[model samples]
Structures are given as structure tokens and as C-alpha cells.
Target: MNLETFLLKDKIQEIENGFKIKNGWLLICESTYDEIESKGIYCALIKNKYLEKYSSSHSWPINYGYEGKSNVYGDNSYQTYDNEEVEPFLFRKSFNIKDGIKKYIDVGEEFILFYRLFEEVADKQNRVYYFVNDYGELDEVIVVEPNKVKIKLKYLKEYITMRDMHFFISFEYMILRKTIDKDWNLEFIDKDFSNENYFYNHLIRNDMGTYQSWILGNYFIKPNVSKRSYLDFDNFHCEEFIIGIDENGEIILKNPKYESKGNFTFTYFKKEVLNKYYNNPIEYEIDSFSVSNKYFRLKIDNNLENIIPVLLTDLLILPENEQLHWKQYNIPITEDLKLSSTYYKTMILGNWYESPESIDLYFKHLYNDFNKKWYQKFGWNLYKPLAKEDEFNFKALHLITENNIKSFCEQTLTIVKLTIDRINEKEIVKGIELEPNTKGISKFQKFLESKNMDIPDLFEFLRHLQSLRSGLIAHTFSNSNKECKKALEYFNFNERNLIDIQKEIFKKSIRTFSTLETHLL
Candidate 1:
């Protein structure tokens, strides 16, 4: 599509300022900003492909505008960031349906499409303005003069921006069917034009950006009322001036400009809709699977998938009495633990134990329910309402891998160390000030000692993790490194199975948290 296709009157005239197309309906005029003479202030007419940077194999002009100039401004502004070439064939004809009135626009790909109701109020002195209210009914606002109407229209634009667009927009296009069947009202059927687009092509096919067709729903268009008003002065010397001309060769001056110092562009033309109904449904599910052991195999799906995991978890984490209840099913304790793999992917290897998310969820429940008043005294302080940074770190604490071992360790160690430090700092929780610079595992050890607590196994586990980081990550990797070897031996894991050690350590950390919650509370 070329300029001639959409041009109702195809005449490109040379005006005093610059090039005038469609008589004077649209002008590429000379615009001067400040004292600097430049001419790049108008609605750009170019291809849609040029909208995105590095989208096409195009090379843009280097010196079209000054450094740091935005794409929305200056000559060939519509040109690609790197202009391959502004091929004549690249530009296409498009239509913008503003206020029920269809008009032409220039784009490279598909047409820009959307409906805006009440874009411009009629300027006639006797014209009645009906603004869409919260109830989808038009609210009458009478203005005797055109200028007053313009002012109210400007205020209305601001109101739309400040308030919800839904209440102001009409949704008739999406909900209403053209046939006026048993479902839709006759009034809506007459106005709905979306059905035509649903069948037709080469019309207003896409919106300016995303290129999506009009969203489905019921809506009505508000018409454009503000006509093009030009600067009457011939020697139109202003600090800055940007103008938009319609296909009818008239200048629109309703754009916002600072009283003395600022720029002027066209009033934001809006195509609005009113929607009455909306619904979003979840269409997600996981497939069924089987849990097999030496004795039996249980098929799982839906509720089974959801319920079995918790039961298995209880068998591992709950008291002996709880463990006995599941044994009635004739499932071995070891087999049930392995079946946990069906639910949580991050569960410790085949043991199907717990994930970071589950850990956080566990602590959150404990904090919210049990330690509401004394979270700082209990270990729930870290998770009662995790800080934004801590929440981010915790969310990132997923399954360990060779690629993410370093990050996983760093994030895990940070969370644990922070929790320990927070507990130590609380005066309600008894602790000692061993040294000002005490940090990490040593610091945690001192805090435990201050509380007269002895958990040598937990301390050793933390030290092993710290050593892994220090020897393998924080410093440098060496096969002969004793600290690294000790850390690996502590988990009965070797260099090849480092990920396994990380996973084991992660599970231990969760258990350590459980211990903290149990004792601290």
C-alpha cells in the first residue's frame, strides 16, 4: 500500500514551509526549536518494522539528530535504528478509527486498529456532551460555546489519565455479536463492528504496538470533537512547536504547551471502549504417574498427587505415631519417602523430602500461627515476613546444579547466616558478644554456646558447607585441598558428585531450620 491508496485526495503540494500531502490535510513542515533551525516535528509516517531497534537488517542514519535523541523526534525518525534502506515498498497504508471516524495512517507492516469513543467532542454551540459514567450511561454536560467544550475535553483527558480507563472505556466490541441473537441485546448488535473484522482482512487489522486485533467485549466509540486550530500569526516564532495535520489540511493546536516555555504537540487522540463482562480461567494440570517399590506400585493423579506427598512427608518428618498410620497401607517407609519424588522435584534425591519453597512455607505458617508475638525470640523472625531482598534470595534458592552450585551456596549460606545473626542480636534471645568481627559458622557457634545449646552435628554441617565455598568457589579449586576434601567426605561425596553434596547440605539446612523453630519457640 502506498500514499495514493489511503489518500482520498492524492495531491502532494509544495507548501511555503515544507512538503504538503493530501492538499494540506497532512504537512511535513519546517519547525524551528529555540534559535536552532531544524525541521522534524510531526507525526512520523513510516513502516511498522522500523518501530523496533535491531528488528530488521536495516542501518539507520547516524547524524539525523543530536546524540541521545529519542526515536519519536527529528527527521527520518521513523527510519530504523540502523537504516538498511528506506525502500518505497516498505511503507503501507493503515487506518485509525478514532471516534467512529475511519481515517488513513502510514505504517510499514499491518494497519493500526482500535476504537476510541469521545476522542473529540463536537464544537457546535448547541451540541450536548455526554461523557460515559461509571454505570455505562452517558452523563450530560452542557456547554454553550466551542472553547468551553475544548476546555472540558482537555479536563476530561486529564480525568481519564488520573482515573480508571475501564469505567471511562466502552467494552461493546468484545461482548456484542452482530446477529442480535438470544444472548446479545439489539442495541449492542447494531453498533458492534468487530464481527466484520473477524471475517474481513486488509482493514484496521492490528493495534499500533503488539499488533493484536481489538480485544473482545462490548464497547462504544466516542467521536473526535476538537477540530484543527492553527496559530494565526504568520511569523509564528515560538520557542518550540510541533503540529499534526489531518487529511483535510487543518492544524490542530490543542496539544499541551507550557504557558511560556515548553513544547506543543497534538492532543492525544483516544479510541475508547466500554466493557461489561470479563473472565480469566486457569487451564493448567500435571499428568498422572506411578509410585513403585519392591512390594507394590500405587498409581497417582489429581487428589492422589496432592495428598500422597504430604502423607509421605509426614512419614519422614512427623512423630512415630504418625509414621505408624501410613504403614497400614503396606508401603515401606523407604518406598514412601522415594514416592515424594512424584510431587516436589527438588526433594532430596529419591527421598522426596522438601524444597526451599516448602521450607519457607513451613516457617511462614509457624511464624504466623505460633510465634506471632515473639517472632524475634523464635527463629521465625527471618520468615514471618521475609524482607524484599531475603524474599528474592529465597525464591532463587532452587535445586542445585554444577552451573549454579556457587550461586546456590552463596544464597543459601547468606540466608542461614542472616537468620543466625538476627537471632543473636535479639536481647530476648540470650547470646554473647564474643568478638566484634565474628562471622559465619564461627559466629553461629558462639551464639549457640551463649544460649547453652549444643548441636555439634549442625555446626559441623555448616562448617562443611562453608569449607566447600572457601575451597571450591570463594578461593580456587584444587584436588589436593584438605578443606575441600573434608567438606566432601563429610557428605560421603566426591568431586564428580559435588551436586549431590549440595543437595544433601540443602536438606540439612532445612532440618537445621526445623530444629531452630522447635527449640527457639
Candidate 2:
């Protein structure tokens, strides 16, 4: 049979309706809802195929390739092919329903077909589809094909027994079932009653014996005219009675409050029905009540409004009491100066100064010690021979003194020459150019003249002293160690003091350079 021919919209609708009414039979299984919805039109087509076959009482189990099995059709053993031919098809076959109900009654393959149909239907509808057992109980079935027929049936029965089944079947399910079983009774129960109590008292009370309560709960009460008795049935209710007609021709109670005319009739049902109707049936405003345990009654009134305010007040007062308690126990105290003497003790020991801060003071003390040592080592009265007749303890001192003076003069001349070169490069001085005539002394003097700068008198004197110290140390003198020691002391004092002075002078020079650059620019 061509499965495509059965893919009609009406047939799909029929299958959908069948699933709604059939307890536990979901045309759309819960698992496949997302997948089917995502592929909407494609799902609809596949669903149509199943619904059409289902409506015609044919099997529409999705054929997944099956396992090999042999079957005897006419007393001859026919070996079933152990390939795709024997494998259950993933798509349903037209003869699946009849074959499933008949030959495959206990076969593991039937369960696979059952679940496939269930899944296809459930997927298209986007709701959980279920299967029903012979006991009229609804059951949730697994999406996968069952390996054992008994297991599948057991699951179906378990799910049906566990779930709270809905009595009213969907119109689509009824339509499909009607196609197969036209003589099937289609009873429509009235759901327009305000409360189950009224229906129990007035309408379904008489029909209780005819209609069994498949599930237990509050039932509608109605008059069973055929039996001439009041019936209370779980599923059926009556329509509103007209003023002129007997119970047989009366309008079914669709909406009685809207239909009833007289004030007395309307008021009676309104008070008992409309006023009592809970918009949200799940929630209710319960009143305080007393419970009796044996001989005594315990009254419990735990309304939120009455108890919350007192709780809030108690919470607010707790922090204030804690603060007061802390204040009472924690007293403030101050220590006496005598008890904390660290600062005073450090000052008294004279070890209170940081190294960097006392460096200048330390250097001053060192300078004083060096000067004293120098005076003691070499007689301070000894001086450069003012006259040629003065006898010198060291002859080398005179030569060293002359060399030192000459070196200082040469250095000063070099500095002057560099300055002159700079001035010439900048074209700052534009008068007569100074030129040296002599080879050595005249050239040196000329270099100084070009820069128009002179060496300081103090620097010249220091240079002469350095030369004298070098000579004395180099000469074979009786007290050479003494002279050398004195020379070292003098050199150290001058070197240290000069370096410090030069650092200050360099800083000032940098500031002068900045000013000069600004002005020149």
C-alpha cells in the first residue's frame, strides 16, 4: 500500500483527536515534541500517514529494519532472511495494525511499532502521548522499541495505572475511532455546572448505578428518568431544566446561571454556585480553626498579619541591647608616659638618628680627625722653601710641586681651548682672533685669553700642595711614612670637600643652562 496516499490533513486531525481521548495514547510522544515542532510541516506529513492508516484499522508502526526470525505460514518451515527483509522497518507498514493485533501478539516487534506510532503522534501535537492497557489505565511508554513483548505490555499497564486519566477524549481521537467503529457510543458529559455538589444533588444522583466511577472523586448528581431514580455518577451531569419541559426534553446544563431567568432561581444557584466558585481552585483562604486531640481542643491562629509585626519589633530591639551591653563591658583606658618609655629611651641612648640624616655630621667629624692626624704626622710649620737658601728635608718635594702646578695649568688651558672652540662655532665673539706665538707657555696663555676666563686662586694653591705631597712621598726621606700619611690626610680632606662643592656647582650650572637656552631661543 502507498503510505503517501494516506497523508491527508483530515486523517492527521483524526489521529490527533484519537490520542486526546484515548487515555495513555499520545499521537505525539513527549520526547519527540521538540524535534517534531522544529520540523513542523515534515512532521505533519509523516503524522498524516500514521493517522490515515490508524483511522482505517491498519497498523502504522514505524518500521525500523528488523531482526531475522522464521515463521511457518503453511506447515513448511521458511527461514526468515537475517537481513533488511526481516528487520523491522523504521516507517510503519499499512498492514501493521492487523498484523500487530493478530500474528505479532507476543512478538517483540509489535511493541516497537506501538511506540513508533505513539512517538509520531506525540511529536506532531507537542504533548506527552501515552498508551492504554486492557484495564483502561493510561501508561507512559518509552520512545525506543521494546525487545520483549511482555516488557512493553507491562510498561503500558504500569503507566496507565499510575497516571490520573482524563475521562473526556479529544474530538480527533473520537473521529478516528468512529471511522473504525461506527457503532461506538459517543457520550458527551456536561461540564457547565458551577460546582460538583449541585450536579451531585440535582442531576447525576439518579444515574449512579448505570455509570461506574472509573476514577474516584466528587461526581455529578442527576435524575435517571429511565430508572425513575436519582443517580450520582463520576462522569455525567444533566442540563438545566426548562420551565415547561420534563427532564427528557430539558436543555442540557451548559451554563445555568446565564440561562436561569427568575430572580429567585438565579439568586439561589448564584449564592450556592457563583459566590462559591473559586477562580483559582488550587488556592484558598483558610480560616483559623481548633483541632481536638483526644479530650482537649488546641486552638492555633498563626495568621501572618497578627504574628509578623511582633517578630519585626523583637528583631529591631535586639541590636540596641547588644550595643548597650558592649558599652558596659568595654571601658576605654590610656597609658601613662612612664609606662610607655620607648621614645624617651631611644633619645637618651643617642642612637636615634637615621644613617642618611646624620651623614653630613659624620663627615664633619671625620674631617676634623683627619686634620688632627695630619698635623701630628707632619709638622704644620714646614712649608715650601720661600727662599732658595732654606734647607729641605725632601728635595723631591720641589720637583713634585712644580709638576703639579704645570699639570693644573695645562688642564686649565685645555678647558679654555674647548670654550674658545664652542664660541667660534656659535660665532658669539667677532672681534680680533687671539693667536699664540710661543710653542708651549705662550700657547697655553693664548688659549686662556681666547676664552677670556681665569683659573681660581684656591685651585692653583691646591695644585701646588698636591705636587709637594707627591715629591715628598717619592723622595728617600727619614720620615717618609709621616709625610705620606699627612699627604693622604690632606688629599682626602680636599677631595671629599671639593667633590661635595662640585656637586652643588653642577646643579647650579644645570639651572643656568636651562635659563640660557630659554633666553637664547
Candidate 3:
């Protein structure tokens, strides 16, 4: 028997014999892809065919081309100035499908196209294939000729015999026509399907009630099949029943919607079939990618880094077909980033930013996010915390200020000294001038010249600090109250300056370290 005939008259009749909801298309949830790990589409059936637009709407805060800012919508005088209200479907129109698949799945064309299944339209293509809601439970796909379908289904069941098989029979597709009032809203007037069946009275006759559209969505299992097969429809048979070669491939079924699903069969009526049949997927595969090992890797957003000389930097998420390996890296793969295999190998084999401009922008954004926090963290390490009272705290002049001004100045001086050393192995220990009678200002000047860092103001501040410590601070035991007050006053203003310069020193040092690791692109 034709699947549609068996489904409409016998199968549906058997299922709907005494089922609770008597009015509409009914597909029940029999199983899932993975009960815990898998998240598939399981939605309500019984649609309201006439009412247009879903009650819910989505918002994407990007205004114009800029993210996190608003643009054109405010000028409209209407007090209802909500961005979504002004442009309910703006996000979908603003971006392409690929981008829509990313950043904002619930907005744009993906939203309009994918989400219509959620609303009770019961018709994704405005046609009812199977008159049902598909619960996205089909993980594996098997493609074969129409006569070979029984063997194909059996072959499919073999893959499930050992592993758990999740069968999902969705009943939400049961069509329900509601009684409505002046506003055309559902009045909930209960008309029993127990008496008049939409399947016999309307759908089978090709006279769709009220809506004037075919129900039960459909798709072509063999999208790439030749046109010759379509032209030779007169010789078609029950093999056509399993899969049809149309008798008059193009004469009847005026609905372009009907033309899409071949002549008579309604199995592939919905877009659900296309995702499976278009490529003709076989065994269910986990649609994700992960790094190969336990090594923690950076997942940066730089696509340009792919061409650089850097090694072991960032793993850009790639698509499945684009992947080379998926051996369980520490990175958790999500639908947002399927994580490509080539990108995975590239991720494990890191690269650095070669473009100076890109490096600057990337580092600046990194600094703003967390590198500045690290600078603050290092500043804490450079100073000694002094508690004046139970709840009062103050940072001392330097790492070990109580020892002497010489110790204090030396601590800060090491930052620049160590930085230069880290920047180049040849420069290590070369900056400290150990000449005859080299002391005080002469020594400081020689040191600054040898290091030749971009941070001059920082060294100047360090010099002034050294002077204060050598003169007034070194004699802490013999200092008068007036001198102590003077020292405190100097520290109050200069301490902040010291911290700011340290931040710059840290920024430069970080750049230098990254430079050591990278070859400029």
C-alpha cells in the first residue's frame, strides 16, 4: 500500500481511534537522538492556519553596522520605540544565512524559516507533508532506490540494534480548525474530528479546507537524480509507489508547493526532508569537533593568523567537513562552533599575529579585557602592603622599602632591566655599567642609555624616588615629624604616578615577550 494511503486511512485511523485530542494532525514522541546529550526539535502540533505572525519576536541589539550601539530607530516619533517593535524581523534581513547560523540563530531568515515550525502554522512550506510535526530525531540517513526502502530501513535498524535507537513519532501535525469570533481569534468551539475527518473530506480530494493548501510536507530523496528519469514517467510502477516516476511529470497540481514534492506523494512535503535527503546522510555522526589532546589551547577569532609563522596559538572553530581530527581536546564544541579539523591541527600548531596593526588591535582588546588586570596583579607584587590599623591598609614605596632607598629603587629598576634581557639574550647583563667611580646620577644615566626603553617618564619617576629615599627616607630612625610628613605627602601624589608608569612598563614588556615568540607578518 502507498505510505500515504496506509498512513491516512489505516495507520492514522488506528492511532486516532480513541486518542485524547480528536481534532488535528497527531505525531507522538516515541524516542530521541540522545536523551541526555542530544537536544533536538520537539514542538507542539495543532496549528491555527489563518492567524498570521507569531506572538513572540526576537531582538538583536546591533544598530546599523555597529555592535552594542543604537542607530536609526530613535528618530521615528512613535512612542513605541522598542528596537524589536520597530524592526521585528530586522536581524534576519541584516545578515546572511551563514552569519545568521552563528551569532544570532533566533533572528533573521533562520528565525523566519526555522521558527515557523514552532508556530501552529503546521505548514513550513504552506503544505502539510504527513500533516505532522517532525521532532528532528533522525540522526542517521540511508539513501536507496524506492523498491530497496525495506532493506534500507532494516539496514538502518541494524546500526540501532546494539546502540540505543530513539524513535520519535510526532503527533503535533494533527490539523485542527478552530471556531473564531469577529477578530478571527480561536473561539475554541470544539468541533469533533470523531465525526468529520479532514483526511477523507478534504486532504485526499486535494481540496484543502479553508486554507486551500496541501498538508503533510515532502522532500526528494534523490535531489541529483537525472531529468531523463522524470521524463520516462509512463513506464513508472509501484516502485514509483515506493518512489514514483510521475505519469505526467508536469501537468496537474497547480501549486508550486505541490510541484516541488513530485506528483502525488506527500512524504517529502516539508523542508525537514531536504536536510536529510539533499546530501543523503547515512550513519548518524556527532556533528562537532574537539582538539586531539589534553593540552589547553587558545580559541581566538583571528582568521588571518592561519597564514602566519607563529606556532601553537589559537584554534579557530571549523565546520565538520572542514575538520581533520576530533580526538577530544579540552575545548567543548557547541553548535555555535562546529570546530574544523584543519583548524584543529592549526590550533594545536599555534601561530602568532604578524600584522603590526592587527597585533595592536588584538593586544589592545586583550589588555582591555584581562591583560590590564594582570598589570594590576604585578603592581601588587612590586609593592609591600602596610597595614596602619585593623581596617586601614597602605602600599609601601617599593618591594622592600624598610630596608633602604637603594633596595627600593633597585626593585623597580629590575623591571626594565629584566625586560630588556628577556627581549634579547645578547642584551642580558650588558646594560649595568660597572665603570671606575660610577655612582648616583652617572650610573642611572648609563643604565637608561643602555636599556634605551620607550618608557623615559618611568625612569625619571624612578630617579626622583631614588633621590627621596637616599636623602630623607634612608634615615628613617633619625627622621623628624616634619620630614616624615613631607615624605608621606610626596608619596601620596607620586605613588599613583608610579603605578601608571608600571602599567606602561608592563604593556611594553608584554609586547616585547610576544615579539620574542612571533615573527612579524
Top of the candidates by lDDT:
1
Per-residue lDDT tens digits for candidate 2, residues 1-521, read 12221122343443323332222222221111221121111001112213323232222122222323445557575755333212221221123574463211122344345443233233221222345433232434433232211122233322222321111111111111112223424243422222322111111111423321111111111222232111112222222221221222221222233442322221001011111111221222212211122333322211211110011111112234332221221111111111112222333343443211112222223333433443454333111212333211111110011124343333223222222212222122234354534322234333445555344432333333333334442344344556445544544544554334323322332332333234322
In model 3, which runs have C-alpha deviations exceeding 4 angstroms? 1-352, 355-417, 420-444, 447-458, 461-502, 508-521
After TM-score superposition, what is the CA distance of residue 1 in candidate 2 from its true location, in Å? 25
Best by TM-score: 1
TM-score for each candidate, following the candidate numbering: 0.28, 0.13, 0.18
Tens digits of lDDT, candidate 1, 258-314: 432222111111101000000000111111222223433333311121123322211
Candidate 1 lands at a TM-score of: 0.28
Candidates, ranked, lDDT: 1, 3, 2
lDDT of each: 0.34, 0.26, 0.27
Worst 10 residues of 1 by lDDT: 271-280
lDDT of 3: 0.27
Ranking of models by TM-score: 1, 3, 2
* Model 2: residues with Cα > 4 Å off, grouped in runs: 1-9, 15-23, 26-68, 71-86, 89-104, 109-521
